[model samples]
Target: MSLRAILLITLQQEPGTGYDILQRFKAGLAHVWQASHQQLYRELDRMRGDGLLTCETVPQAERPDRKVYHLTAAGGEALDTWLAEPLAAGPVREPLFAKFFAWERWPADARRRELGDLHEQLTQRLATYAAIEEEWFAAPERLTPAQRAPWHTLRLGQRLTQTWREWIEEVLEEGE
Candidate 1:
């Protein structure tokens, strides 16, 4: 999916300033789609030009005017159209898988180190998800209708991470 589509869904979820949108990506959507600072700002402007979004300038006391993006009617329609279409299966571009393929070339010690590093990264991600759950989703039953989708996505992330971690542990144990 294009950054434009993600931006549309984001604004549709809750309109906010550019910084607010960036924070949303960092907090949640970054897990699904990654975008650079420049990509986001440029896309927001392009979306505005395309009439998919409207911007409102709010003056601050000492800061530059904050531009808040609101989804236009066209943007909503675009998002709806995009949602209705079936997504094609994307290629698995995992570099770790490539490392697995090249396992014979790397020394055994180096392989262990790589596996250890991956395990550490996955553990850290799980910890981050746990933190997010504790901070925002302590009580899933109380989530608003709008929050349900995100909550489910978080659960999915946790499950996927656990599965990956388990697989890594199995591989490491087998290698010993």
Candidate 2:
């Protein structure tokens, strides 16, 4: 999905400043979609020009004015139409998987180091997912209808991370 669609989805949850949207992406959407601050700001401008979003300038003390965004009716329609379309499975583009595919070419020590690094990264990621899950469970009432969809995606991320960690452990054991 285009970043525009993702931003629309976010705004549908609530009107927010660019920073707020960025935080939302960092907090949850990073699992599936990622955008740098510059990319998001540029897209916000484009989406505004496309008439899919409306922006409000709010004055701030000791800071520049803040621009808050809200999805327009057109944006809602665009999002709904996109959601109705059937989605095709995209090609896997994992760099780590690519490295594994060429493991035979790497020196033995390099392979071990790479595997160790991946294992460490995956372990840290799983811990983060666990924390998020715990927070959600602790405040079930805070989850809104809009959050339910992303919550399911978060569960998928947790499961996938767990599976990846298991596979990494098996590979490490095999290398022993």
Candidate 3:
């Protein structure tokens, strides 16, 4: 989903600021949608201008004023409509898979090093997915069934990483 769409989904829960949206990205959407702070802020502005969100300036005691965003009625309607539609399927564009596909030209040592690095990265990623899965199971009610896109995306990441790790193990064993 687009950043604005994700922001709309979040605003459905409560009015929130740009920083809050960024926090959500770091806390939950780090895997599914890799958006920079700049990208999110820019999208927020565009979404507000397009009448999808309403912004309110909230005064802070020690910090600068924060602009809280809420989804407009139109935004809610849009989100509901989009959620009811079918999602597009795309090819898996994994960097490690691409690297492995072109590995025939690399020296044996280089291939071994690449596989080692991939294994390390996948191991860490698996840990991340496991943590998210725990959190998802802990409070299943906080998120709507249809709005669990980030968690669903995390599951996909888990499967992909696990498969790659298994393949890496096989490759390393064959090279022995």
Candidate lDDT values, in order = 0.88, 0.84, 0.83
- What's the lDDT of the predicted structure labeled candidate 2? 0.84
Clashes of each: 0, 0, 0
* Candidate 1 off by > 4 Å: none
Best by lDDT: 1
**Candidate 2 per-residue lDDT over residues 1-176, each given as its tens digit:** 78887898889879999999988887777777888899999999999999999999999999999999989999899889988999898887788788777778877788788878988898898787777767664465687876577778887998888888899889878983
lDDT of 3 by residue, 22-118 (tens): 8877678777777888888898899889988999999989999999998999899988988898889977777767766667776789889989998
Candidate 2 global TM-score? 0.87
- Residue pairs clashing in model 2 are none
Please, what are the lDDT tens digits per residue for candidate 1 over residues 1-176?
Answer: 89999999889877899899999887878667789889999999999999999999999998999999999999999999999999998887888788777778878898888888988998998898888888778898998977777878888888998898899899989994
List candidate 3 segments past 4 Å from native: 136-154
> Which pairs of residues clash in candidate 1, taking residues 3 or more apart in a chain or in different chains?
none
> Which is the winner by TM-score between candidate 1 and candidate 3?
1
lDDT of 3 at 24: 77
